[model samples]
Target: MPTEILMPALSPTMEEGTLAKWLVKEGDEVNSGDLLAEIETDKATMEFEAVDEGTIGKILVAEGSEAVKVNTPIALLLEEGESADVMDNDAEGTQTTSDPDPQPKEQDGSGDGKASPVTESDTPAPAAPRDDKGERIFASPLARRIAAEKGLDLAQITGSGPHGRIVKADVVDAKAADAPAPAAAPEPSADKAPAAAPAGPSADAVAAMYQGRDYEEMKLDGMRKTIAARLTEAKQTVPHFYLRRDIRLDALMKFRSQLNKQLEERGVKLSVNDFIIKACALALQSVPDANAVWAGDRILKLKPSDVAVAVAIEGGLFTPVLRDADMKSLSALSTEMKDLAGRARDRKLSPEEYQGGTFAISNLGMFGIENFDAVINPPHGAILAVGAGVKKPVVGTDGELTMATVMSVTLSVDHRVIDGALGAQLLEQIVQNLENPMVMLA
Candidate 1:
């Protein structure tokens, strides 16, 4: 029997995507997860992978085809030893725009499920412990092969990684602490860090990265087209006003450091993003209007704090949701965030991973960004922007000057459902949570 690879819905709002480029040609043997093509969604150009093993029987939609619709068969997979009947079948059922409904491929909330390596349902039972890199190892990363040859117990040595994952740094650090170690690090180089923001790459520079290949471009696919239309509509129609604030982060930074020290053994390291998410969720409960979507003439208030975090992909972006952000623990949120982000980058996210957001957060702190305003992703009235925290001077209670970590945040509000006062009130509550460093727990 032949297999038909159908077009996947990249986002809930996505009706179609452009068949950006095909990686395999007819007669190319492919296994599950072999890169098949690149799809240009409004948010990004994602690589599509083969879901089942087969040989490419025929190519239906040539590269740069923009006239494709959802459920359209773009390629045919021929079984081994089977004559090319697959293409004939696909051509027989040539998808039509006239059909309003086609059975949609199973989609989860975060991304398209077509090219996934594995799903939660297929996840094998946990196997015996593997090394930090998930490979079998006789000795710890620190103990070295000498220790492995001597059958030394790495568990006896204290670890530096969460849950003792045993990174090489921990072993060397342990060695250095045990005995005054040789200086290995090079002296800091002058101009190591640039003072000014770097300029965005020009067309020439980006084109050079492709090794001088003249690449063909195509029209935006259904997802990108819809995204362009919707976001454009939002920016144009939605009355957007932003409130910016700088927050003292000394307490929050200390809280994270202290919490990581306690939880490292349990494999949990709290990130600042987790606290930000928690604070947003907690603040939403008190400021219910922020947790709402402007549905035509009325506001749809959400009962759950489903906070979506925008993740950047190759061409566009995807916002994988952190469902019930307020109900989850910091560790849980951290784990989920890692899983969601990893799967998102891999282009294996499900539809549910991208839906159900009462509020949204877009943080650029990891990139050392100081501050930025975010575009409001709709149905959600508010989106928060979080910036990096850096140590700075501050006045103490006793009239003494001290150093404190400070962060900047900006809240973009849809003015139709919110007033300046209401937006300010929500921002103030979020600030309180960050300042306290413990309100997140509540």
Candidate 2:
């Protein structure tokens, strides 16, 4: 039988991706572990590998195709003893169907004591339906029944099930689209008509206004689109609260300078941001309850302080996480952060390198911005926005005045998981860690 090469889901949240390029063409012989194509997800461009050895019989999707759905066949493969002619629509009719339900695990008397393989007789009656165009549209019987009930066009909906087979969820979404809107009110006189509600201008209206403007219009790419969507969702759904504090960086500066001087031989120079990362990690340890994330229905308290640092890239920024940050040395954290940031700017970071962190740190100090509130990244309990350090006069504990370098930071807390008191405690620990820099090393 001819096998189909389906599009793969590169990331957990990826629904569709661009088929960036194909490494093999029709009639090319391929083996397992061979590079099949390059798929560009919203986060990164990943290389897809062949899982089965076969000859590329047909390429259904062309290169540069956007929104190619996961599990939709991108190509057809001719297995051993199969010819290219097997890809004909007539051959599809002879394809065998398997049972959708799981078979009872009957243990065989073999020494391995494994369950027997399901047989063809186990297949239930009524195979998948075909479209009027004489093409096989893989859909479950329930989905077809629901589409019939709602009079929905099954061909228009994209399937998210295994092998791109239409499922119940897809049918529900399609049915929702087919729902009719409420009838409009009867037209009234000019004086009686209600005034239009205030809202943002439409895309067409804005474009008309900027038609003669002296500016270049740039289109949003995949990364920018994802960032906009995620941020918008975060702001709309997550209840946020902000806490601000000013920390004296004199001790951290002196400690970093002395360490850098001794480590000059090893070429390991630490940055202030590196110290911030470590301090946040230790603070999470001191206040473990605050080291949590807001899952949809529950809060997840973390054990290790996995810290995500925001690194700005060309089109969008990447938050590469430093895993088990509390256990690593300051020098190790600095080195890892530098490598991750470098890869992020080059668009070469993997999804695992930039995803899943309990907390985040966004430092705009390099840009000379002073204390701004940052939006809480979803799933993270809070994010610390660090501002530039500047020399400011402060009243000393001995009733005297002195000049010290102070950095202002704002912690944006997700009220769903972190309360005001807990957030304040976490920020207080971070301040203490920064003030007494030697305790962090211990």
Best by lDDT: 2
Stretches > 4 Å off in candidate 1: 1-12, 18-67, 71-228
Deviation (Å) of 410 in candidate 2: 0.1
For residue 430, what is the lDDT in candidate 2? 95
Residue lDDT tens for model 2, 181-278:
21222232243111122236886898899898897778767777778777877887899999999999999999999999998899899999999999
Candidate 2: residue pairs that collide: none
TM-score, structure 1 vs. true: 0.59
lDDT string for model 1 (110-150, tens) is 12222212233322111112333433322222233223333
Report the Cα lDDT for candidate 2: 0.76
lDDT of 1 at 15: 48
Kindly state the number of residue pairs that clash in model 1. Answer: 20
